[model samples]
Target: MRKKIIEFKNFNFKYRVQAEPTLKDINLTIYEGEKVLIVGPSGSGKSTLAHCLNGLVPFYYRGDMSGELKINEQDIRTKNIFELSKIVGTVLQDPDSQFIGLTVGEDIAFKLENYCVEQKKMKEKVEKSARLVDIDEELQSSPYRLSGGQKQRVTLAGVTVDDVKVLLFDEPLASLDPATGKGAMELIDNIQKQDNKTVVIIEHRLEDVLHCDVDRIVVMDNGCIICDTTPDELLSSNKLGVVGVREPLYITALRYAGCDINPEMSPKSVKTLNIENCKSKVKEWFEITTISEKQKKCDTILELQDVSFSYSQEKQILKDVSFKINKGDMVSIVGRNGAGKSTVSKLICGFYKPTSGKILFDGKDIETESIKSRSEKIGFVMQNPNQMISKTKVFDEVAFGLKIRGVDENQITERVHNVLKTCGLYGHRNWPISALSFGQKKRVTIAAILVLNPEVIILDEPTAGQDFKHYTEIMEFLIDLNKKGVTVIMVTHDMHLMLEYTNNVIVLSNGEKIADDSATNILTNNEIIQKANLKETSLHELAKKCNIDNSIEFVNKFIDYDRRVR
Candidate 1:
């Protein structure tokens, strides 16, 4: 029998800042060499459990706790975090929050230096670990200058350099593109297989980890384990979906079609699942009506002509980018990390002046306008929710933008309340910002911008860590706003969002505009998919396997049927 690496007995904890317990009576056992996933909505004690495993729960977090927590057959209460660090290495959810070194090389060696390793051996170990995570080439590069994907790699390398036997990842895939996230999972699998390491991954994105060869998945809610089962069983059961756990879109579609997902009747393998049936159901659910000729012929809102931008004299980030966003059009900008998707948003918001060519808003060049001046025309919601939040109360946060624009108190209150309810935050209007979860904060930031009712609304990574329920709500709200004559531009890596919500797609590669077309066209073009670091949707993949060449018809049928059944 494998060793029991982590054991929690009747454990309960409450943060010093709060009166209620975040975790309650958690009983769990993590065996050695087991890859366990702890999942739930934000603020569900997933991170709290991770902190407990790493000895940060009662130490750094200053929380009241009762009962026993053990790691590596040792009680964590008996040791400080520094002593427990030798047993478990943690890669935080936010890479930027844990960076301790100026360069990648130095950061990897930072942990080793604490042990007083000889300089020569330290160099060899640092190089080996850097190569392990594929960041060797970035050894001397400043960590601050690295892209989101590269920053994630640096954090992974930093955690593993100490040769810790237990590895804990707190949403490591949050900032990565899908391709990068998949690669990271493969690397993790390889490491566990070769080294027999115990891996505990905390993530809300279930699709990325579904195929990873994990031994067990422990689902958490309200600081307690709700479900503990294998990946195959978890995927086959609809219980997770009922509780709002965001399973893969394919699985969700299958469940909607009245397909029994039991061990014997479940689609079983993603490869073996009849994708045509699933797509037929998805199309039925979507009820995708063709755009009216008049709607398609709407007037242009913004035009980009021969726009080019370069960060340095030798390195150009964007080259000759050109596109047009029509009035009331919901457009998605998608690409790999660091592909200049965010740069296009900045240019649209007047944060950066294009090196050449013109960006015509209402057919007039606004290159000279400041970000503040352009706020009247465009509303920009940043990627990090923490950066956008400033006021203490939710109502005040949403009203700040309107107040700054010289709106009266009555108008501010009315607009704020309306936008709050639209974003599903009206219930928490009087609540302090500190009381909300990460997902709630995201909605708050969006609500603040949405209340402004700008001509064009631009959101950067609007649904990065949101759950399916929240994703649907946000997209539905945005769709309503678009119908009300607001142009929506979203910078996202979520393929599902692009396919199910947006009307147009813009693919970027190395900061260049590679393809601009409908979502259907982009999905079918293999070359564009490769360039933009995306794969065919699960529905598309399944359709090909079932020999359905007409994806449009398949999708329409699938969505229609799914809707009728629902």
Candidate 2:
């Protein structure tokens, strides 16, 4: 019989600041060598459960707890944080936050050093771990200079070097590009197979996590586990959407085509999914779901002419980059991490002036205008909400922009309330910022920018840490604003968002513009997808396998149909 690695019985926990329990009457069991994926909407107690397992709940968070929880058959209440670390190792969403050493080698050796391992043995372990993660050549490189994927590998090396029996990944793919995310998942799969370790992954990107072989999937909502089942069973059921979790795109597409897939038909990854059994159903659905083509707009609202910028002479971030964004356009800037996607947004927003080139807003040179003047016409929402939020109360934060512009008090009240309602934060207008969840704080920052009534809004990874429900809510609001003639430009690594929402896509590679075309065209081109380090959607591959004519066109039209129906 397999050993039970972790167990929870009638577990309940309430934060000191909240009135209700964050985790309610939880009962769960995880066995050795089992890979489990935990998914839920924001504030659904998924992270809280992870905290409980890692000894952060009562030890660091100071929460009121009741019930029994065990790790390796030992009561967690009897163990402190330091003791828990020996058995359960946690790798956080932001790998940089977990890094303690300046270089890759040092980072991997940190925990071993703490344990007073011999110098020769510590060096051997660090080198072995680095090799496992395929980063042996980067051992001497600084962690700060590594890409998102490399930094994550360094963190993984550090966690695994200590011979921990259990591993916890807290949204490992949250900040990575699609290709890098796939690599990370594959690395985890290899590690699990080699070590036979008990692994648990907490994430909102269900589709991405499904790329690996998950033994079971646990769905949470409102601090309760609504469903616990295998991937096939969960995908076959209608419970995912009901609980505000997003189902995989191919699965969603099958259902949208009016086909009831087999309950036992679960494929490990989208790339390897066999759709031969459902070809007829898919063909019928494709024939019915047709959409008309949209006409292109030509009014240029923002233009970058031969722009070049550099933090120092040693490195040039953008070189002779040029592009024009039309008014009312929903444009997406996409590329791999460190490919200069966010830099383009910053240059447009006047956060960094180009060393040589011109940025024009409404045919006027924005470089000549004051930062305050430029901000009035263009608003930039940062990637991190905590960095943007300044006011204690949500109401004041949203209303501050208008008050600074010398707007009347009555008008400020009217504008603030309307934007808050649009962003779905009206009910919590008077609540303190500290009381809000990460997703809620994100809405507050966007609401603050919306009240300013800018012509164009630039968002950097706006939906990075958001759940599917909140993501849809925020995007729908942006779509409504776009219809009213506000330009939306998103810097993102999410292919689904780009294909479903944006009309145009700008491909950037090493701070240079590679392609400017329709979202479908850019994604469907294998050469461009490879050159830009973008992942091809499974829907596109499925269309080809079904022998469907005009596969790209079919995928594009289906996305349009899906967007309209939603």
Candidate 3:
């Protein structure tokens, strides 16, 4: 039998501020060198559980704890935060928040310096750790100067330098692009095997994380561990969908085609998935599934004529980028982190003036329009909710826009309440914004924008950290608003979001407009997907693996079927 590295026996913890326990009656054991994944929806106690493992619960969070918790067969409650750190190292969801030093070498060596290690030994350790994460070449470079993927590598190296026995990752792929996220998982697996360390990942992006291998998947819901099983077992059951976590797209596609999936068929990774037994069924279903032609809009509400942008004379963020968005149409802007996706949105919102080019709204040149004047016609929901949220309560934040416009008190109340209901935040209308989870705060921010009732809303990663249920809720709400003639432009890294909701997709690569076409066409094009750092849909791959012709049409029809079924 494998030795247990971490164990929790009837553990329960409650934060001082919370009325109820965050984790209740949990009994879990992780063996040495085992890789495990913990998943759940927002407010499902996953974060609290992770906090308990790293000693953030009793030391930092100030919570009431009961029952037994052990790390390496020692009661963790007897150890302080410093002692816990030596056993397990944590890599936060956002890499920037964890960074402290000026350069890559300093950040990784900061931990050793605190321990009063000799100068020569510290240098050797830092160099070794940097090389372990493949960041040795840029030791002198600033961590801030690196890309999102590189920033994560620096943080990973910083944590691994401590040589902790357990590595805990919190939403590791939260801020990464599709291809970059896949690479991060592979790197993590390689490190785990090379170091023989136990790994625990807390994430809601189940499909993306499953690109790696895990010994077991622990599913938490409503402050409890509802299921603890292998990935194949988890994917074969309906538990993931019922819990509002997304099953892999290919698994969902197999079920949609009426195939019986079993663990023996390797249902976890797409590359190893065995579908020979159900290939005929999938082919027949693809043959019968039909998709209707999409209706195109003629009127262009917004147009960019050869727009170019640069932060400085040295670096041009965007070059001669041009596209048109039709009125009442929903569109997606997609690319890697530095591919100028969010930069394009900022340019459209007039947050940053283009260095060169013409921007027209309804055939009117608004180059001279003030930011306040542009706000009246265009609404931009920033990526971080903390940037936009000003009031403590949800109602005030939602009504602030209308209140400042000289709207009557009665009208503001009615409008804000209606928007709150539409955003699934009606029950929390009076709750403090600080008490809400990240996903709830996201809905609150979107609710504030919807209350303004602008003709066009440009959102940056609207559903970046949201689970499947909230993602579906927000996307379906946007679809309703689109049908009611609200044009939505989203800058996102989620490929599934583009294919599922948006009719038109704009792909950016190296600060240039490389592809402007339908979502299916863009996703199915291997060359375009590679250029933009995007990943192809598993449904497209599934169709091709089953020998179905025209994989593009197969993906299009599947999206339609999914929308209708929902």
Candidate 4:
């Protein structure tokens, strides 16, 4: 018989600031050695549940709680935060925020030091934990200086150092690239096997998390658990999309291709899915699907000519990179972390002067232009919302740029409100910035930039931590902006976003521009995908499995239809 490790019986919770409850009448049971995924749209109380497990609800958050919650058969009310920490180890979405030690080894040992473990044992445990996460060589390096993937591994090492029986991961894949995310998931899976640990992951990236074997998937909405079922059952149902959760891309493509999936088919089967059973159906659908012709390219709006940049003489970040952005184009800048993707955005935005090269904005050299001058023409939204948000209130934050330019109150109000509505934050316009969730704060920052109405917008991982609903909302709004003649440049690691929304793709690898072409073309080129460390979309694989003629064309048509319907 499986051991029940965590249980919630009719639990309810409400934050001190809110009038209504954030969690309502929840009943759940998680068995030992099980991997469970909790998924929901933004503001769905997923993070709140994680906080409860980590003893952050009543202790840190100061919330009113009722009913019973237990871990290892002990009631949560009987245990203090310090005691709970030994039972449940939490790794936050932002590893940087959780990091305390200056160096990697120090951070991993920080937790052990608090418990006053012997000096020899502490060093042994730290090294062992670091090796488990594949960060042994980075022991002497600063935790803040490591790559996104490495930082996450460091956090994992710290959490596992104590050998806790239950582990909680909050959005572990939010900031990682597809390849790196897969690696993280594999590491977690291995840890669970070796330690028989009960793992709970709260994330919006369902497809990536599903790569590992998941015992159950819990779907939540509006502070309620709507469904709890296995991965096979959950994907077979239509509830995921109805509740604003994103289904896997291949599943979406299968539905788009008019293939009636067998009710009993498991999503696990889809990983090595054999399409021979439905080949004819898929082929017929492809034959009938209308392929939309590509849109005409507009005039070049910005150009980078032989751009070469280096932070130091020993390390070059960009090597003779060159590209052109057309007016009203929705282009994606994609690559692995530290592959110079964000650096390209920085160079274009005038954050750094190229070591040797010239950047042209509307046929004029921007090398001599100041950042303030560049800001007037181009708007940049960073990946982390906290870095971009300034004002205390959502409305004020969105209106900060307009007010700085001496805009009248009436005009500022009109613009701010419209942008808020477009960004889906109109209801929270008057709310305090601190009251909002991470995703909501992200929208607020984007709204602040959109109100400025710059000709070009550059966003670094705009949908990094966003759920499906917010991702669609933000992308659709950006698409509308592109239709209005604003050139949109997205620096992202999400291949789905690149394939579905953007028309042009710029592939960067080790400070070099390897390919600049259509999204379909870039995705279809194995050489470019490998060089840039990009994962091919499942749709591409689906087409090949079905043996469809001109698989690229079929995938392209499916994307077109998907966009039109959405």
Candidate 5:
């Protein structure tokens, strides 16, 4: 039997500022050399549990604690963050915030320098760790200059340099594109195998994390551990949907096809998870499921023609990107991290002047329009909520957009109230923005834009790092808004959202437009999926294995059926 490295018994924790306990009566034990996955929705206390392990909960967070929490047989309450830092290293979800040095080499070596390590040894260790994470080549480059995936590697190298016994990854996939995220998972797995280290991952992206094998998966909700079991046992059960954590879409599809997943039937990869009656049941389900025809696009509410952009003369951000978004169409703009997906939206919002191109809103060129004027018709919610949130209080922040537009107090209050309620943020309406979690802050920013009621709303990575429940609420609200004649454009890295919610997708690669077609059409094309750094829905793979000629229609029909059943 492996040694016990982390143990939490009857543990409860409440932040100094929070009204109630964030973690309640939790009991979990992770053995040394074990890879455990902790999963939950936003505010579920998974991140809090991770903090407790890394000595951030009681130390940095200044939380009230009860019960016993021990790491390596030492009580955490007795140790400061520095003591625990040597035992467990943590890679936070946001790499930008984790950086502490001007360049990659300095950032990775910051901790060693603090410990007064010899310069020669520190250099050797930093280079070795960076090489392990495949980030050694960028040692002298500014950390901020690298792409999201590269930044992730730098952070990973930073943690490994200390050679901590246990590695804790909190939402590691939150920053990378799907293909890059897969590579990251493989890298972490390889390091663990090489060192025999204990690995604990806290993430909402369950399917992606499952790319590597895990010994156990611990599910949490409402500040409690709802289930602690192996992957086979958990996937075979319906607990994922009940706890509001997203199940692998392929698993969900299997259940929808009337073929329940059993313990023996479950596998880490969708390619190997074949059910006894899967083919027959799925084909029958497909036969009976009728996909509704797509509604005709009403008018050209927003159009970008021959758009080209560059920050410097030598580098191109977007090149000759042309696409038309109709009034009330829910569209997605997707690509890799540095593929300029967000830049396209910024140009549409008049944040950047195109090097040479045309942008028209309602049949007129928007070249002369001010950003403030463009925002009146089109609202943009940035990928990072912190970038947009200004007011300290929640209500003030949401109402700021409306008030500046000279709306009356009564109307502002009513509008803000409705938007907050729609966003599942009504309860946090009076709370300080700082007190909220990262995901909650995201909701507030969306609420701020939603309260203004723009004709077109463009959200960049809107559902990134959000829990499944909130993702559903926010996307459903967007759908409702679309039904009521609001056009929605999402710049996202989430493949599930792209396929399930958006009808049309615009693919970009190397600053050039690659494919502009229906989401189903684009997703089924392996060439486009690989080129865009996007992953194909398992539904597509299932169709091909089942000998279905048209994977596009299979994906489309299954999505329609899944939405109806849900």
Candidate 6:
């Protein structure tokens, strides 16, 4: 009989700094080889639960604890973090923060070195793990220089090299691109199946994992496990929506079409879900309408004319890349890791000088523009909020840019408050940055940029570690900003965000532009999808399969069904 790999019986915990428990009475048991996904909105105690399982709760974090917790059928109270590490391998959300070595190979070998493993055996394990995670080519490269997805893969290699029985991933897919995220999901499933290892994933992006052979769904809310069930049953249940977990987009599309359908149906078996009945429901929902008034008036705001960039004399990162973002346009730049999406943003903001060609903003050459002058025209929000934040308090963090530019103190206060309200950070204005959750920190970063009121805004992976609700709010806020003439360009790997928020899409592969066109057009094109290593949005595929040329309605139906199922 398989042993229970993890057990939480009437467990409750409160951080030393907090007045209340972060997790409460979380009763859960994960058996060997079970692939479970724990999900919730931001601050729902998902991270707290993960911490408990890996011994971070009582070991490193000073916290008030109640109830019992066991791993590998042994009480957690008896083991320190190092002993737990022998049983459970943990991969955190940010890969850079966990990296201990300069190169990928060295990073993967660090943990083994601490265990006193012989150098020969360590090298063999490192190579094997590197190949397993498909990062053999990156073994010699500096981890700091790799893209976010590559960094994440390297972190996985480091964790798995220990040959731990159970693996815990905290938002593993957050930093990965569509193709890489899918590959990571498949890899996790493969590991679980081949080794009979217990797999626990805390993630907000449910779409990919829902189809990846998950065993169970553990939904949390306000420090409690509100529901525990199989993925199909969870998706099919109405309580999930009440509890606020993100349902599958395909199911949502079906629901929006006025069809009473269950989201709990396995996505892999979508073909058998009476797909024909779903077609007309979707048609009625969308009504084949043209682009909204807000979607129109997207005139050319910035143009890259045969732009090429290189940091070294050896090779160009961006090769003659050219694209246009019209006024009131929300455009997404997407590609595999290290494909120059962020580099393009840097060049547009004058952080990096292009090797050849030109960038035109509002029909004026920006190559000669001073960094200070360019700062007034473009607001750049980096991927990591911690990097952007300088002040201790949220209000100060939001107002720092304006204060530096010599704005009046009173006006800065007013603008800061207004932007905070817009970004849903008003309630926490005076709170310290350390007190806020990751999603809240991201909002603070965006609010700081928005307060600057620049003509153009660029966000690098804005929704990377955010939950579904936060993701939607940020996208909607950006859409509103674009409607008011703030041209928004986002460097993203989020396919759903691109489909729902952006009007224009740019596809890149191996540092070269493969396609630039309307979001709908680019997403539907097989050539671009293949070249860019992108997965098709489920609703988009369903429409094509059912001969639904006008896709809006079909997608809407899915939206409706998805809501009902959730």
Q: TM-score of every model?
A: 0.92, 0.95, 0.97, 0.98, 0.98, 0.93
**Where does model 5 exceed 4 Å of error?**
none
**lDDT of every predicted structure (CA atoms):** 0.81, 0.88, 0.90, 0.89, 0.89, 0.82
lDDT of 6: 0.82
Per-residue accuracy of model 5 over 1-566 as CA lDDT, tens digit each: 67999999999999887789999999999998899999988888888898899988888899789999989999987788998998999898889999999999999999899899999999999999999999999999999999999999999889889899999998999878888888889998999999998999998899999988989999998999999999989998988889899998878877787886787876556866765567888887777889987678869888899999999989989889898999999999998889999898999899999999899999999999999999999999998999999999999999999888899999998999898998889988899899888888889999999888899999998998898999999999999999999999999888889888998898999999899898888877889989989887788887776666777888888888878877
Can you tell me which runs of candidate 4 are displaced by over 4 Å?
none
**What would the per-residue lDDT of candidate 2 be over residues 1-566, giving only the tens digit for each residue?**
99999999999999997899999999999999999999998889998999998899899999789999999999998999988998998988878778888888999999999999999999999999999999999999999889889988999899899889899999898889888998999999999999998999998888888888899999999999999888878887888889888888777788887766665455545566667688898898888777877878799999999999999999999989999999999999998889988888888887888989999998888886776877988899987788898899999999998888899999999999998887778889999998786668888998899888789999988788788877888899898889999999999988889999999999998889999998888888998888888888878877887788787887787788888878
lDDT of 4 by residue, 446-466 (tens): 999999999999998889778
Collision count for each candidate, in order: 14, 0, 0, 0, 0, 21
5: Cα error in model 2, Å? 1.0
Query: At residue 197, what lDDT does model 6 achieve?
Result: 78
Query: How does model 3 score by TM-score?
Result: 0.97
lDDT of 6 by residue, 297-328 (tens): 54678999999988787977999998888887
Candidate 2, pairs of clashing residues: none
Q: Which stretch of 10 consecutive residues in model 3 shows the poorest summed lDDT?
A: 464-473
The better candidate by TM-score, 5 or 6, is 5
Compose the digit string of candidate 1's lDDT tens values, residues 126-192. Answer: 9988888788999999988898778888887888888898999988777777777777788888888
Q: What CA root-mean-square deviation does each model show from the true structure? A: 3.1, 1.9, 1.6, 1.3, 1.2, 2.8
